[model samples]
Target: MRSLPVYVASVEAEGDRDETLRELVTTDDPDLAEKPIVENFTTEALGTGLRSLRYTQTEEDRTIVAGVRYAWRSQEAGCDVVVIAAAPDPRRILGAMDDIDAFVEQITLTVSSG
Candidate 1:
């Protein structure tokens, strides 16, 4: 859940998905550490809280498909979903959203003091 927000922010800031991915590779988070470096993904969720993933990276069979799936799911909780695979750089990840722009802008909307 936390990783979803972090992933989006990191990719948006770095502008190079590959580099950001490299950053993810070096992260301390257990989940990010286990993500598979594969080109494809498969996801399965059981009983709402159990999500399992299996994908093939060139080196290891274990992968981070779970986090990716979670991130996609997070958007539905209150956001628009955007999925990107094989982003060599963050900038390569086009179509990034304002992420509930209306919600954000509403914060600035003022009311009469009367």
Candidate 2:
């Protein structure tokens, strides 16, 4: 049995990055809409033309989750890459942020330019 919400991180290829991001940020769940977003930011980094965003949102049950998403265009890879991390609890997420950031920094992508 899982007490905490199951938040999964994933990366995939997609056509519309902004549209996908908007879908993620906009809360359709009535439970989550009451409070809305707490804070959010976006930037490009990683030296591979990577774009990323981190946002925290208030859940319907009054709990909160922080999420990070990264996207980049890759020709040889056949599509753009999108990476996501969904954290259900701020305290626990914050405590692990340092380790998380370090781990993310190690991710390397080789996109071939044809």
Candidate 3:
């Protein structure tokens, strides 16, 4: 059996929207193997966003953890939505990218106007 770890969250946006999106796609963690690979992404529900690939090496076990992060700023909701998919094996994460992307595409955000 195989498992993929995923996290999804939404937070209030602060400062500039573009800056917030940029920050979400960028990481400066020391455990990272190298600079993350980031790309522009557009989702059906969230609109334009960013995606990043990161590999972090664990110090205790010396294992590489592969992660993919997707971030989008919801103008209607005035918040940022982030989805992260991670796996111990890099190949697992890579192989599941398509499914993960599809899942992201299905996300929907709604805001009511007064």
Candidate 4:
């Protein structure tokens, strides 16, 4: 399968990852699914070595469905992560709101010829 083309922006964040994440989670939408926030934060793993946070957020939710992932790619680690939220899908045109949702999704797949 072919990979989807994603639009990404550079993010360089300074501060505590857990604290920033919590603030982002709350500031962005305090009512978002707790599972995404409470259950999925790997702060311990993301701590210590993290001097500065660098990642990209999804920027496309204009035409696609909701509850879809807005993502960020850890440039140093080569890991792509999603911010658990969906931007409004009313306009197909990209905007600041769209930029808030960085575009990138990573998946594993195997190929076989039959």
Ranking by TM-score: 3, 2, 4, 1
Instruction: Report, for every candidate in turn, its global Cα lDDT versus the true structure.
Output: 0.27, 0.46, 0.87, 0.33
Please give, for residues 14-96, the per-residue lDDT of candidate 2 as tens digits.
65755654445443334442433423332233334332334445655655665544444444454544455556655655565
How far residue 68's Cα lies from its native spot in candidate 2, in Å, is 1.9
Tell me the spans in candidate 2 whose CA falls farther than 4 Å from its real position. Answer: 1-60, 109-114
Ranking by lDDT: 3, 2, 4, 1
lDDT of 3 by residue, 1-111 (tens): 487867889999888877787677666657789899888889878998999999998889989989999999987798999999888899999999998999899899878
User: What TM-score fits each model?
Assistant: 0.19, 0.45, 0.90, 0.28
Off by over 4 Å in 1: 1-11, 15-17, 22-28, 32-37, 40-65, 69-114
> Please, what are the lDDT tens digits per residue for candidate 1 over residues 1-114?
111232222122333433333343333344343544333222332111111222223336443232222121221232222232322223322222233222222221122345
TM-score of model 1 vs. true structure: 0.19
In model 2, pairs of residues that clash are: 31-60
**The candidate that achieves the highest lDDT relative to the unseen native structure:** 3
Q: Between which residue pairs do clashes occur in model 3?
A: none
Q: With candidate 3 superimposed using the best TM-score fit, by how many Å does residue 73's alpha carbon deviate from the native?
A: 0.5
Candidate 2 whole-model C-alpha lDDT, 0 to 1: 0.46
Deviation from truth (RMSD, Å), model 2: 6.2
Q: Indicate which candidate wins on TM-score.
A: 3
Better of 2 and 4 by TM-score: 2
Angstrom error of the Cα, residue 25, model 2: value is 8.1
